[model samples]
Target: MNTDRFKENFLSFMNGCEFIYSEFKNGDFGDLQRVEVESFNKMGAVEFWSSGWVGIDLVDCVSGTQEISVLLSPEQRDLVDGELRRFADLMARR
Candidate 1:
């Protein structure tokens, strides 16, 4: 689970699912997502969102609350899931 990698790959993670934009006139990116993960019996999550601007977050599965959203494409779900799994695994190891 690499926070830096997630930060670096965030935009690219959404690339495979860009076609979802067709669902809405303003759907220029993947739809917002709030995906939670299980780490050491605790809950973790990754989120992406934007109102006036775009943003993403990989909530540490240690002591963070649910406050994230990501633009998810059908194709990008796997990518996001992998990232979250890695993140969760890393946190669980601590």
Candidate 2:
């Protein structure tokens, strides 16, 4: 995966998604902050985190732990999935 491109385009990976805000969260790093964006339907969320390493999380509107796949179109799901794989690769490299 081309993580460089993924990193550059991460925020706009999904269309119609609105960027919410980033806030600090207590974690292993003690300064982890998550960048959150609401899904287009406002029924889910995509989050990006990079305190000491990169990570991505998809929050289902209900389950919270489930991926936002249920709320996304097939194309949108592919885009998010690809970015997620790239994020995983980047984190592994780190």
Candidate 3:
């Protein structure tokens, strides 16, 4: 995979989601590391790693907001839930 392209696309996706993201040096995936995305609504946060294709969810303690982190494999990444097909299409286009 082209790491640079993937990073660009992933960042675009995050931007489209209205989430602010940054690459942090130390994380579960080691150096070359994790992407930290915070929800614009301040409801939750997520940390994603490409190495193991993992995602972690963190929700606001007081708000009790529901947070979900889905870890998709390369193939699974292309699959879209019916309701999100349109949004998925937009993401794929990027």
Candidate 4:
């Protein structure tokens, strides 16, 4: 949950994946933000967005957006969930 550890883990997760670059309105801040992610396994041209706390798969390449409620594999989900929980705990302590 420390910044250093989070960066290390995030980099490890993202390494070797081909990330497509894009950005959009986040609705909170009046500014656009960049999104980088490995291409969608099924769609081939979509990227995922972070839901503030954790990254959730989202497709915004086409006309309508694709809401990925559950996209990651079981093992990947487990890893992400664990990391998110750790991050929350860390924030609470601060």
lDDT of 1 at 34: 38
Candidate 3 residue 38 C-alpha distance from true site, Å: 2.3
lDDT of 2 by residue, 1-94 (tens): 1233444656444555555545566765344444455553233333333333444555444444444232223335355556565433332321
**What are the RMSD figures for all models against the true structure?**
11.4, 10.9, 6.8, 11.8
Better model by lDDT: candidate 2 vs candidate 3: 2
TM for every model, in the order presented, reads 0.28, 0.42, 0.36, 0.30
On lDDT, the leading prediction is 2
What's the TM for model 2? 0.42
Give the clash count for model 3: 0
54: Cα error in model 3, Å: 1.9
- lDDT string, candidate 4, 1-77, tens digits: 22334445554544344544455656442322333444333222222334433344444344445534343333464
Error of 3 at 5 (Å): 4.7
CA lDDT of each prediction against the hidden true structure: 0.40, 0.43, 0.41, 0.39
- Candidates 2 and 4 compared: the better one by TM-score is 2
Mark the 10 consecutive residues where model 3 has the least summed lDDT: 80-89
Q: State the local distance difference test value for candidate 2.
A: 0.43
Clashing pairs in 4: none
Candidate 1, position 83, lDDT: 49
Clashing pairs in 1: 47-68, 47-69, 48-69, 48-70
Ranking by TM-score: 2, 3, 4, 1
